[model samples]
Target: TLQPDVFGLVEAARILCEDGFAVFPYTTDDLIVAERLLAAGCKVLMPWCAPIGSALGPINIMALRSMRGYFPGVPLIVDA
Candidate 1:
């Protein structure tokens, strides 16, 4: 679920939403990515709890918190 191509994901999500499908996107710790995903009708996001395959936990707490702030009520799944 480590989708590096944010714009591609956004376009896909937008299409899905238009077709009445709920979109759950996986985003890195990029706030801009989250914003665009939300705009594309993503009600929830799955962000990395740590780098993929690193086995670390919540590497950037500040970034996570910032993402939460940016989304407010949006649900974020911090994938590990």
Candidate 2:
């Protein structure tokens, strides 16, 4: 399935956050998107390590590592 618009996603997350919901957005392995989601009040980030259900584990180790480095205390669940 095609991904939703990033702007819309952030807006939705922001709204849900305002309503006191913890948002955990499933996202591509993109640091910029992760940053935006965090700013929009997402509690956790679920970044894809590979295409969904491909059984490829940790295809982008550097990206995952980068996320960890960028977000020291934030939880980053691999969404493979």
Candidate 3:
């Protein structure tokens, strides 16, 4: 029952980063969310290949590729 508060994520990440914590956000396969997380000072990104517990691997390879293209230097981990 521990769900992410998506709306407050950026601000929370910002705060954690400012306090010298490394923020690794678990994100969906969305470039915009990745961008925002990066902007908010996330050190690494954990983007899901599919919905949690779906067992479908790399469902959106294009989106993962896009994230790599957009953030070549940032570390991206495939989740779910």
Best by TM-score: 1
Clashing pairs in 3: none
In model 2, which regions exceed 4 Å deviation? 2-5
Model 2 weakest lDDT span, ten residues long: 1-10
lDDT of 2 by residue, 1-80 (tens): 54446677778888998899998887887888888899888879988888766776779899899899989899988776
Candidate 1 has a TM-score of 0.85
- Report the C-alpha lDDT of model 1 over 1-80, residue by residue, as the tens digit: 54467788889989999899988776688988888888888899987778777776778999989888878898888887
- Cα lDDT, all candidates: 0.83, 0.83, 0.79
- Kindly indicate the candidate among 2 and 3 with the higher TM-score: 2
Q: Which stretches of candidate 3 lie over 4 Å from their true place?
A: 1-5
Q: Any runs in candidate 1 off by more than 4 Å, and if so which?
A: 1-3
Question: In model 3, what lDDT does residue 54 have?
Answer: 64
Candidate 1 RMSD to the real structure: 1.9
Taking the tens digit of each residue's C-alpha lDDT, what string does model 3 give over 24-75?
A: 8877767777778888889798887787766767688898898889889999
Could you tell me how far off, in angstroms, the CA of residue 48 lies in candidate 2 after the best superposition?
0.8
